[model samples]
Target: MLTSIKSFFSNELFNTEKGSTADSSEHQLQLACAALLIEVAVIDQEFDTRELQALITILQTKFNLSAEECETLRTLAQSESEDSTSMYQFTQLVNSACSPEQKFELIKGMWTIAYADGDLDKYEEYIVRKVSELIYVSHSEFIRAKLAARP
Candidate 1:
């Protein structure tokens, strides 16, 4: 039993390490952004299947990662997103690394996650909007993304 438990944790930690190292700093910034989107999805204790699927799709498409790689990164992002209490760490990484255009794209991705389940809750929207502003996306661009992602 002890061995099983240890192995479980070992596997989890290994996945985490592998996920973090699998991408370059730029890709990691994008990964962190995606993780934040998932973080908000679970904020209300309603992690729907659709949202998860949409997140995986976006990661696969946007990052040009293989399905297996996307799954690994999604798993790692979910872990990191849940463990974090503040957005400081993620925002700091993105603000320092992402260009203005990339920041706009990131906002769009966040909106995509929020709309994944075809239901946008208030808190989720608020979190994404706040994150967009923090990441330096213009209000107009943020609104455009929000509208575009709506069903």
Candidate 2:
């Protein structure tokens, strides 16, 4: 799995440029964010079509990615989320790479996915809450994000 992730980063996600640490970091950030979103979508064990679509839309819009790039990232993230033991790895990358506002936005995206099917599953909400806490989003801000993303 580690080798697959490394190959993904090296071959599929970004073009290799000499000394391009920024690009590598950016791709890692993208993968981390996508994995979190995927986690929310699948936490209920349903993986609803609406949730998948919402996740794709959020990834494309937030990352400014082309459709193909978004799909590739989504596939990789889904695999990572399923194979993972905890959320800490993804959240750690996010905490290191994202600003406070960016973290809040990610919470909003999670809420969006949670509400995508027009029902808020407890497990979905719990995962979102866990991620918010891991990312150091205040309780108030987490509530604000949920309210704002409520459709």
> TM-score winner among the candidates?
2
Candidate 2 pairs with clashing backbones? none
Q: Per-residue CA lDDT of candidate 1, range 91-135, in tens?
A: 888899878877777778778878887888898888888888788
User: Which candidate has the highest lDDT of all?
Assistant: 2
Candidate 2 structure, TM-score to reference: 0.94
- Clash pairs for candidate 1: none
The 10 consecutive residues of candidate 1 with the worst lDDT sum are: 1-10
Clash statistics: count for each candidate: 0, 0
| Model 1 regions more than 4 Å off | 1-23
lDDT of 2 by residue, 1-151 (tens): 8667666777766656634678778877888999999999988889899998999999989999888888999999988888888888899999999999999999999999999999999999999999999999999999999999999
lDDT of 1: 0.73
Lowest summed lDDT over 10 consecutive residues: which window, candidate 2? 12-21
Cand. 2 Cα-lDDT: 0.91
